[model samples]
Target chain A: MFSITGLLTISGILFVAGAAALITRRNAVAALMGVELMLNAANLNFVAGWRYFWPERLDAHVAVLLVITVAAAEAAVGLAIILNLYRKFGTVDLEQIRLMRG
Target chain B: MTHAQLTALLPVILLAGTAVALLLVQAITRSHRVTAGVTLAGLAAALVAVTRALPQGATPVTALLTIDRFALLYTGLLALIGIGLTLLSFLYLAGRTRLTGAYYILFTLALAGGAVLASSAHFAAFFLGLEMISVSLFALAAYRRDDPAGIEAGMKYLVLAGVATAVLLFGAALLYARYGTMAFAALGTAIAPGAGDPLTLAGIALVVAGIGFKLTLAPFHLWAPDVYEGAPAPVTGFIATISKAAVFALLLRLFTQVHLREHPALFAIFATLAIASIFAGNLLGLRQMNLKRVLAYSSVANMGYLLIAFLAGGPAGAIAATFYLTAYLPALLGIFTLLTALSGRERDADAIADYAGLAWRRPVLAAAFTVLLLSLAGIPLTGGFIGKFYVALTGVSAALAGSPAFWALVGALVVGSVIGLYYYLRIVLAFFQRTPAGEEPAAITRRVPDAAAIVLTLSTLAVLWLGVLPGNTLTLISLLVEEWFR
Candidate 1:
């Protein structure tokens, strides 16, 4: 059911779309979600690549697992930072947070 | 596998263990002084480890870390800066702030991160090294929680850093995708004897851009002034010395191993950034009324000077870059520590007027500051002068004689430097500028920190010791320099 080609196609589309959303989304939370999506896409790519290219290589799976761990950490840190934005400025809008723009 | 391997790892081990030890000590002791003492002790121990490991020299636990002469030299310098900044933090924090325990922890971790960066050879190690350095900096920038400027600096750094991290990761991934490996050596193998595919080229550019951001070179240098202005002075000192040097060291590894010389476009891009950073850093610095911001811009321009050596990526070039950073670490810490001391409890004690008539009030401090500034300007007999002299000589020598890019680097250096001298001298003149009418209360003197005094002594010794007799240090550096380009 989880063919390599199918996984790769889905991951590629998700990644390209997620990246586009990250670049285009105006909402801060949406942008952050886009980041999450992008990260997940990378995770998908890793797993699919593992299955297709090196299915028996434990390190490939391990590397992807490590990235997931780091991604979770990144999300936690990013959300904490966004909490400050929500409290201070009463908006989760990335565009509005441009208060200190150079 | 070898003692050399284990020995090479001493600095890393000392730092990690000390961090754990100090954290435990603080949890139990609840004393900032104890924490500071522990932190200083740790850095000192690490410095000793670095020195002992040198002469006999070591490699890595694996190829992840490359503990050669270059790593030792830079790691030693980072330890010195860390120790100096940690000592300065005592005065900066003593009764003036809270979270001393956390502050010392972040300080030690940042130093360790820098140490890792100086020694890293693989992408995995480089990313970890950079994150270790950067994550702490995010907290350190906002160390003074009450100040909005502190928060602002922190946010800017975080967002910009996130962008840079993403870009760098994408770059690295592209390179890996093309080459099937992440090791610097493997990447070098992939690119050697032929041109890199565009994917690899783009990857290098992204890596360079990420590094360019970290180093605060032009177009990528937006964060320097604001961050420097907002962050506590000692944090600025860390940013100025360790962060910049470590990133450059990593960049040196990437370029030297990748045979970047074969790529004309990449070379031109770096050359352009160097030129732009020098001019923009100088030009923008002139308009700043804030002292920290002035130095921030000046440091950016100095990065341009370092880039000149780095661009060369040859024996003389690598030596020049490392040697200059060695000289820079001390004079740099000296000036900022002096500023931090002069500022008292107020943050950014950097308004131009704060320095007015400083010479009359604090002659010794004022004169020492002047010498340090003069060193930054590359004044004769100062370590900075020797560093800059080598950079210019190496840059001109390495650049293809008729290439526009080559001469552009030269022209930018000359012009930016001349323009730069004006702003640097402005503060010098302000020190002499007759107490700015109605004499605002004498710039409050915070109790001179004993740690600061020690750091100052260390930095001052380093400045003059090398300024007067640099032959020994230069010889030591050249061993790595030879290895770098060979």
Candidate 2:
């Protein structure tokens, strides 16, 4: 049997690693990848919670599905914006776009 | 869904269906005017739906949504704002681009999302509504695709908001795991007072962080000024008024449902956020030369003010919070409308110099700007004054045997308003100043669109009317809160 502790530990690691990449990366797409990783980690947590505690309710399962769909839509928007950024500035590095500094 | 549920969801259906039809129509007719007309009609229809439903009283629409007085009030207000925005967009952005149709479409979608968001009582509905609004905003913020600043703002908002949502979802998952339900009422019953469960506490903290990011509370508000400055003026108005208002309304409902005031630790967190936002918002805004950035910081401070009443944690606090929001919306929208009108062909009229000699050039606009800014600064004879007075009164009333935290919040509110006044008057002073020698008067003074002017006039009346006599609206809000909390 897959222990809840193991799944929880894995999600915890996934979350921290994703957050680290999100903060440390300079590329917008890479940062978005970090976001996706974090979302997936949350999805794993949702499934674990569903399996261990609330198997009778479909809420967590449905929530995980919705999260996946939303993440895809979010990625689509993120990539499109990044594409627009590259078209405007000829680079996708977050540090390079400095037009709005106070 | 039952027929009753369908009837209850009529407003959302009207908005969503009209948006899709409008998008399809754009393929055939390339007229921005036609698109704008459809958008306004859609919003008006949705408003009618809300009115029809209001008399029926609170009705649960499906498991996710609730059609209640609170939701009806917020939805109606946002729809009015939506119609005003459509008018402003048509007047301000027409002929600037051939592809202006998407702006209306996205605007409608965002409005629908806000309506759904304001009505949601379950986590599923909440998350879905939030993502819908956020995704559309990502596109709308960058709608002027040719502008680099627009794209940068879009990217920043997308990334940060995504992180915040992930945190919020994780918190929800933890809570669901512990409590066995995702409904707010169910969670309220599941958790006992002073339970002190570590997992529940952690989950609540994470959820607060996520909501704080959306509210742009201090220490998590760095992205707000930049995004506000970069976004098109109309979109900035939507973000400032409708989007933030819906989220705050939802937070009020969610927090009160859980009886969050029973926990002192959470109270400390709210106090810290409120204090920091007020101080940081005022102090940082003092140095801003760009008018949009100044308003952005002022909005941060205003959110802090809203939190003070919210922290009072009683019927009085709820009434004050709704009243303050109702008062603040028109003032914010009026300023943005004027900014939209004054923006020239090349750039937005956001700099302090943009308003120099404005009173001499455009007397009515300058007058409107003066009234709005005065309201923002909480000057007497303005709606903001009444809002602030009520907030402080709620706090002081709490001070009678309540914790010292309440008194401290009121002190910060007073000090913050004083600091805020200096910056607001600086703008007012610029408006009436004489035109400098050899300075060219911008042509924006001559070509104020009829629609924009109408919006300005309406909002001006709302500001003055609410400021002078707030009794009717205050009583309505009090009654609404009474029924709403039940």
Candidate 3:
């Protein structure tokens, strides 16, 4: 059966998994992918909430669209920054990029 | 939107238009002087627009934005600060980078975003404005692409800010699912005092954490020192001031609307964050040799102090927070401007030892630096002292009104300020120390730019004015807060 609880549970799992990936992954690109996962998980929750609770309102749809647009912009900027880092340091590993530490 | 609503949004419209104009100017002619000139004029026009619209009172432009006196006040302040930063950037970027036009474009866009944040009344607007600022910063932080440290700062900010945005969005989604409304006023009505489901409470917690990261409160503040130490000095100032002030303004508005003080558990959460940030920021700053890192940690503690006033809750608290932020701007900006002036072609002059024996070499510049540092340390006869005084007064009043938690917050404030004094004095002491025979006096030889000198002088005067004659400013802030609450 299609259920709000079921969808929410899946999103929760996705969020945690994304956070885990972000924390454990040393590669910058993979970490960005993790951020994308987390963003999608939020989008999923918005969709489920709209379907189950407030079908009369389109707030959820607008919010999801906005979130998606922001995510796209974020990805573009994130990748560009990572590319610049690669050109200078020749590595995308977060551990290796530690020139400014105490 | 009605005519009144359109008129009320004049400042924001002008800011966005200026950004687009900057791009067209860049496309036609790649002259740095012209681009910088256009940016200054645009920001000046926005400031004028804000002043003109201040009389319009509160006008809800749409479901997303509400232009009230409080919003106009902050918008005006942000534009004024924007002008100062643009001038500083013009000086900082000259001969340092060829791609100067894009920096102005991003800078104006970030200003527009801050304006949006100040006036936003809905979740959509909040998220959009925040992303605007965050994305622009990602580029601005990495503007010096050849510099490895700049790239690292940009990457760290991008990833961490992305995660924060996601967490905040999920929290918003959860609230929407529970309440079926996203408007701040409506959400306030939906959320009863001290009464919320697990999902709703969790949503609030996540949102707080997200903002905490942006504001660089404790535990979420690990990225700040690195980013501050790595990014260009002027950009760090922007991060510390404009970006932080806008977010804090939004936080105050949101919490005020939601009556967060009525929720004991949430109130306690804020208190804990405040205390932790105060101690953590002060304690961590003690060992830092880098001036940028020291300032970064100082900012963390300053935010904590601001929260003390914020948690005091009511019109007085709001007034105190706003006034504190206003006082903070000049000192912070002055220090960064001085840093930019002293920086060499290769890297920023960010070491504590760089200022050794500065007083003997440049007495005027050293005096200005001393005043600025005294302000940051909350010493008497500076704006920072008055700001801190208001915060403590509000905390005491809140405690008298029945919330004993504020006493602890006030205690933390006192302890933090005392600890903060040590590092600030260390820098001051460096300024007067005699130069060793072998060390070079290169920093002293660098000619201070006229524009930078004017900014520093004005900052020192403003700090003294706020400290000596705070009554007028206090009255102005209280009047705005009264109007807002009405």
Candidate 4:
């Protein structure tokens, strides 16, 4: 079996990179891709924790399944919103759509 | 999974069934009114079920979910808010949209998710409930897909809220890594005072950050004003009242169940967040001309006030927070209902100028708005006043019990409330201003539906009743808190 600490280290990097991309990316779709990465990282952590720590308890493994389902759902909604935004503003760049602001 | 579990989950089952029934009804008839009626009936039935189950008191439905007096009370409150939102959505969508049936389905789904959130006993349930709420809210925020602002708001909420959930899940994984369990009841035994493990501390901090984003406490509050401004008025009201209140309920449960108060560092972290949110919310609100943005900032400040009660970390703090939420809800619901009544077919009447001279044309609406605004500003004879009073009292008692930070937090609360009064009164003042020259009188010809009117009137009366005589509610909340902790 592979080392759990190595898996955790890689997962942590993915989480940080995804968070950075989410914050810095201007394209709505790209930002959403970042969100997906972060979610996957969390799922990896859950699976890793379940395998190395609580092998008998299936809750964390079940949590991975739930996270995947939720991520898919969230991504669908995010893409739909982005399409709507593009239809209205002719672009998915978040900075340009500034209709409602203080 | 068993008879007892089935009974305990009846309210959630009722809500889920209603959502599915709504979808089936939409497939056949597609009548918005009928769909809304069915949804309201479902919520009412669930509320009745919760009330009936209240005497059962703190029944663990499964490892994931618990039904306690606290959960039952919040479930009841959530149902009432659901009914109010359904009525407001009915009015907001009538004759303007054909897909209103879908809105009710999503509404019921969101409410059911919130109920689960209030009763969640494990991290798995917590994440599922939270995701259900966020997913539905993403759709609701952009319901008016034609509106660029709404779509943008939805996109932003989707991205940011997704990130926050990831952080929260990672934190849960960390805790599971260290303790080998994700259940709160078991967590207390796993974590001891002054253990000071770095991994555990990091996990807790990430979890707090995740929750803070949802609550829109300052620094994490940048998306709130824009999202609030961009969303439909009724949905904004839902975010302000139902979602925030339920999340606060969950946070309280988690904090107490895990004995987070035993960690002095965590207390310091919460104190810093409370102070920053109060100052930032008040300071940001002072300059906003848009009504929704102003309310958004004020909500942040109010959350700060709630944190003070949360920091007290005992029966007194729990009672104060519950009482404050009890008072805050009706006023928020009343104001947003009035906004829905004033909205035109194309856009909401959100500009301050739209409210100017409102008293001259819609006197009753104006008066109701005045009571709601005054209540929000924490003026005497309003629910906000009593809510603020109890929060301050809780802080003072905490100081007496030897936490100096509570004293400072109370000082900030007072200062923040005074700043808050200026903006709330500005809207109240706009209502009395004369209509500008060469402009038609500020008479909105839109018909206020009977349901909307009833909601406004009831909420107005509740604000006044709770403000003037809060003793009964306070006693009841204290009794529940005592029972909950025991």
Best by TM-score: 3
Give residue B280's lDDT in candidate 1 (0 to 100): 86
**Candidate 3 lDDT, tens digit per residue, B48-157?**
88888877789998899999989989998899888888888999999899989999999999999999999989988989899999999988999997788988999999
Model 2 residue B193 lDDT? 70
Chain B TM-score for the candidates in order: 0.95, 0.97, 0.99, 0.98
- What are the clashing pairs of model 2? none
- C-alpha lDDT of candidate 3 relative to the true structure: 0.91
lDDT of each: 0.76, 0.86, 0.91, 0.86
Give lDDT tens digits, candidate 4, residues B424-484.
9898888888775556333344567888899999999999999999888888888777886
RMSD of 2: 1.4
TM-score of each: 0.90, 0.97, 0.99, 0.97
Q: Taking the tens digit of each residue's C-alpha lDDT, what string does model 2 give over B41-108?
A: 99999999888877767789877888788888888888988888888778767756678888888888
Between the candidate structures 2 and 4, which one is better when assessed by lDDT?
A: 4
What docking grade does candidate 3 earn? Answer: high
The residue pairs found clashing in candidate 1 are none
Name the candidate, 1 or 4, with the larger DockQ value: 4
Question: Cα lDDT for residue B412, model 2?
Answer: 98
Which portions of model 4 show Cα errors greater than 4 Å? A1-3, B436-446
Segments in model 1 whose C-alpha atoms lie over 4 Å from true places: A1-60, A81-102, B193-196, B400-404, B436-438, B444-447
Worst 10 residues of 1 chain B by lDDT: B440-449
Better of 1 and 3 by TM-score: 3
